[model samples]
Target chain A: MIRDITIGQYLPGNSVLHRLDARMKAVLTFFFIIVIFLCKNFWSLGLMIAFTLLFTAISKVPLRMMLKSLKPIFVILIFTAVLNIFYTDGGRELFGFWKLSVTDKGLYTAGFMVIRIICLITGSSLLTYTTTPTLLTDAIERLLSPLKVFKIQVNTLAMMMTLALRFIPTLIEETDRIMNAQKARGADLESGGFIKRAKALIPILIPLFVSAFRRAYELAFAMECRCYRGGEGRTRMKQMKLKARDLGAAFLVAALFCGVFFLNYRFKALI
Target chain B: MNENIIEFNNVSFAYDSEIVNAPAVVKNVTLSIKRGSFVAVLGHNGSGKSTLAKLCNAILVPQTGKVTVNGMDTADNGLTFDIRRTVGMVFQNPDNQIVATVVEDDVAFGPENLGVEPKEIRRRVDEALKSVGMYDYRLFEPHKLSGGQKQRVAIAGITAMQTECIVLDEPTAMLDPRGRLEVMETVKRLNRELGITVVFITHFMNEATQADRVLVMDDGGIILDGTPKEVFSHKEIIIDAGLDLPAAAEFSDMLISDGFNLPDGILTAEECIEAIYAEAKKRGVC
Candidate 1:
């Protein structure tokens, strides 16, 4: 049951998307999100959808996995689409009953919104699906290095993130062990009601927290023994370098932005 | 250069030194570890062995006396980094010591902290992992490895720093028998091939028999310090310190007491077997 979590799910591969520099991939993902929001009319939305599909195909992440990423947001999608169909105004009315009405414009807007959201999700998921979490954090640290000018400890924050990511699986396994130990000791964690279950978790959480603190103390000592003195003179082993592929990706994203702007200007607003 | 990689000059430490009379965990200990020697410290729980390991790298400065690593005083804050660089430490808990998800990244952590160039770090990381027999596991996540494998990775992390001496505080205590053997073999190889000094702190008597020297600690003081055979020969001191002699030594001692001819200071099963066979042949019994 604990293994169902798909957060930070990265599929390893040697595909083009996987080989792209993580920093550039992150920047491109941000630009893709903005372009998706700027999309207007069927032409712009279609372009965005095509861009997402191409990215997914190049990423080599299975199509089933891409659709699985959307499963968790199914409720939100249905809720938003239903609201858009029932409440949106403009264009010719399609049907009406007792002050509730649906119009062609409403249908158009619902379809556009759903497609826009799907494109946005897929574009960002492609980035994570290709880049490992370690590389992603490295990219973030480099991207945010400028913040160091404000006297902020960007390196320290990034180190904390890296440590946290490294320990997630370890801590999850610890939690599983603790839970089973508790169960063996006659702790009824599963059959309880909502409040009872939460209360029952107190036993597990207290021990978990204690062990986590112990781990942190030991890790700090280990790090110090390795001559870790903050990030002053630290050099990274995996250095991020932008290659020709990054430039090509940047150009393609620029073209995507321009296409969306042209489509928005050429077509009338749907909602 | 001094022959000693680490020297403890009457060092004593207390976690809470502010109290009027806090008991020192390490009590007036004066010792020197020779360069490139494998020394195993044997002590039961609360025997200050862990505190001594911490002092090797300046993780815990001596409150009363002085501790030096490679001629640098551990108490001096300016020399702490250099001291730690010369003497790396591997703690008991492997899970807590590993700081990276991927094995190679974790191995590179020590060199990265020392500001080694990216190219050098990569080369050293590969070399260290290969030396520990973990080169193939470099790209593997640490969590997926066995307990013994994780401990080896932790050792590789220290090796990448190219430290002259390594102080491990019960690194194999949490491991199973197989895991303990794996760690011991890896440590032995590092010491034998790379000439890395090892100050292994453990309670397992058999593990200590493999070391060139052994120090038995009790009540925060060294009870015996000599070659493994000499130390194990003092059976009373070992038993009084809440410890046990290695199985081979104990069996040999029992045989000697039962009117059988057996050699003294037998520390390995093979040695005991050979002695017993010699005795039997002398008597024409087999």
Candidate 2:
């Protein structure tokens, strides 16, 4: 059951985005989201769509995967469009049925909102899809190092993230092993109602929790033996270094934001 | 004995149910293993060899009596970490003990956790990997490695910690023939070339032949302890414990039963061949 959920999991490829510093990608994504929120009207929305499409193409991520990520949000998207279209009573009232009144302005907002949301999901998924979670967390730590002035333990957080990522596959593999073991003992996990199914998970859950604790204890001991005291003077094999292209990426995103923000004020004010 | 690296005295451990005595999992076991020696402990599935290995480094403290390593009591909570470092453990399932995704990282994990300097860790990690001949696979993910390579990496992990002795519990249980051979060869190399005290727990009698001393356990207690030849000579004791003698040992015994006066205490294929040749020389049959 855990194996099929591959939404934010990275797909390895030789793409420019994949090669970019993790810190840069994270910062750019934040600014892009801001730009997305400020977008208004057809030209701005079209620009956002074109930019995201260009990102998707460059990431070399399969279109099928992006579509898969949008599957769970499909219901929310439909509801959002419907609510915005029918409930708004601004501009020209084009249709009226029962208590519902469709307006021209409402249509425009609804259309733009849907486009913005779709773009937002795709753009964010692109970040995770290109970079492995460990590198992503490392990038986050480097980016957040300034918070050390507040005495924040960035390395600790990064370590936690790395450990979590490292264990995801391990835990999934463990769960599968335990399920198979239980099934061998004639534990029927299938063909049960909600309560029975929930109860059946006990065998798997108890073992998983127990093993997780065991692993944690062993890891602690093992780490201590290796002289892992804490996040003090640790060096990494693959250092998270920024290149000229990283700065260029930030500048490019800044330009995109400026253009998007100006269009929002100018276009919306005239309208 | 150069030094008694491991000492167990009247140690008994039980799950502590209502039952009395209950044939303690490790019953009244008193034994001392010398440093820089390769010792193999053999038994069937329920013979408690694994329990003994765990007690060596205080993975599970004895319910009664004590286990001490190099004068440090395993029961000493303060020295527990030090004791664990002094004697590292490699379990049967390589998948269960690995903490890192990458091979070199997994090896470095031990020294890194021990709070060694980054440069020192890098040096030890490289040396440990080279010791096991796996330096080339430094960057590879552990899951991508073969069973033998994974086990080698696990050994490298302990080696990098600079543990003087390593307790390996059925380390080749999950491996194929080639993998099992690879692991056994690595264990022997670590014991002889590196002069690391090795306490190996295994079911395979052939693998146990490489050890300096062979200890057989049955019903949660040591049944026999001696040199491999002296230990394997007790065929009846081994068969009663539901474990077999090494094939070469068996072949030697078979020749003796067939009315050939082959000398006893044969422990390997080469030894059996040499024994047959000696008999042929006596009879001018060679």
lDDT of 2: 0.84
Compose the digit string of candidate 2's lDDT tens values, residues A181-223. 9999999999789999999999999999999888777666545
> What lDDT tens digits, residue by residue, belong to model 1 across residues B41-78?
99999998988888888888988899988889999999
lDDT of 2 at B38: 95
Worst 10 residues of 1 chain A by lDDT: A1-10
Cα lDDT of model 2 by residue, B107-226, tens digit: 877776666777787889999999988999998766667788888999999999899999998989999999899889888898889899999999999999989999999989999999
Q: lDDT, candidate 2, residue A52? A: 91
TM-score of each: 0.96, 0.82
Q: What is the DockQ of each candidate?
A: 0.75, 0.25
What TM-score is obtained for chain B in each of the predicted models? 0.98, 0.95
